[model samples]
Target: MTQQEPAPWDPALAPADADRRLHAPAAARNRDAILSVLRSVLPPAGTVLEIASGSGEHAIHFASALPDLTFRPSDPAPEALASIAGWTTQAGATNVLPPLRLDATDSAWPGTLPPGETPAAILCINMIHIAPWAATEGLLRGAGALLPTGAPLILYGPFRRPGRPLEPGNAAFDASLRERDPAFGLRDLGEVTALAAAAGFGTPEVIEMPANNLTVVFGKQAGR
Candidate 1:
């Protein structure tokens, strides 16, 4: 008999180790909300690679909930890798793969893409808005190479537009990001769409998510 799965957001689990670092506490808070969309969008069974999986909070959370699927979480930072290992150990999650050393800026992905298989899905949440445009270009292009036709490149984050009224919080956030580095700020949706097309992803389906964010799903083009 198949074992029943644990709830995605549970209050009754044993405590996490204090030494584990979770840089984005907000990830845990928003995890359940994200998973609701993921459950609907993600394939029933296949490998899912999460890019820039800071602290591995989403890796463990989603893996636990979607036990039928395997989750591979990757980040370039060593500190993030350590946190991911810690979270995997703490959660006792079997479906989650070891944290991979992947930088979205790299042309070649680090981990072995499964034999005779592309990753069923490529996910990146809360990354492009914070990183430089080159990173965004790399992400879309690299993901294009790693996914099959119809596969999804799921991006979740805030975006900007020239004519649209900016949300007060997002405007302030964008200002802060620009202050830190003028090159970084919320990206425009139309600009991102063009990048996706150049990278071989088809038209994107934009979904409004909670907390002023959007989920954009772009499909890979037919036949490479």
Candidate 2:
């Protein structure tokens, strides 16, 4: 993708400004809240592999806040990778490493630096629902392979829960996503949990988040 191009899943990447920073208004509003949860859950002093780090806004913000942890932001699109680097440089965030070109549907992610060191956490924010179901399956499979026992795989986004009324806003959002791509829409939480279980992940700890979203954290099962 060219510098001018934007990824289809990255709806928040608006026009860039003078600093080569791509703007995402929603990132500003949600970063702090996300950070609060991350601080409490993320393992201390370890590599964090963030999937679909669009616009790199969250990378800079999270890296700046969690100075002890190294952040590896990644996306499939070239433009998104460039935007990640631009924002990381602009923020002067040393903890934020260079972005990787990672397609979630791929069988596996490229190895991180320093050889065999496993990541302490894998973070995917508002990604799977915007993409295809295959991406979600790939994410679980990759996390199962990469993360150590007890490591966290965190997913944040709107989810359709069993026995819960679908919020009107989420329903509309799901409709819009389906319109964009028939394969993309809010996922059923029960289905996601089952997939995680099959991938050797423990039961998810679900936390309701702002804007009718959820932060679902799954732990890698030991001895699998």
Best by lDDT: 2
Clashes of 2: 0
Tens digit per residue, CA lDDT, model 2, 101-206: 8998987564533477578999998899888999999999888888889999999888899998788778888888899899999999999999998888999999
Candidate 1 per-residue lDDT, tens place, 92-186, comes to 99998898888877777633454664689988988886678888988988898778788889998778855796677677778877886887888
RMSD of model 2 against the true structure: 5.1
List the global CA lDDT of all models. Answer: 0.79, 0.84
Return the clash pairs for model 2, or none. none
lDDT of candidate model 1 versus the reference:
0.79
Which segments of model 2 are wrong by more than 4 Å? 1-13, 110-114
**Per-residue error at 116 for model 1, in Å?**
5.6
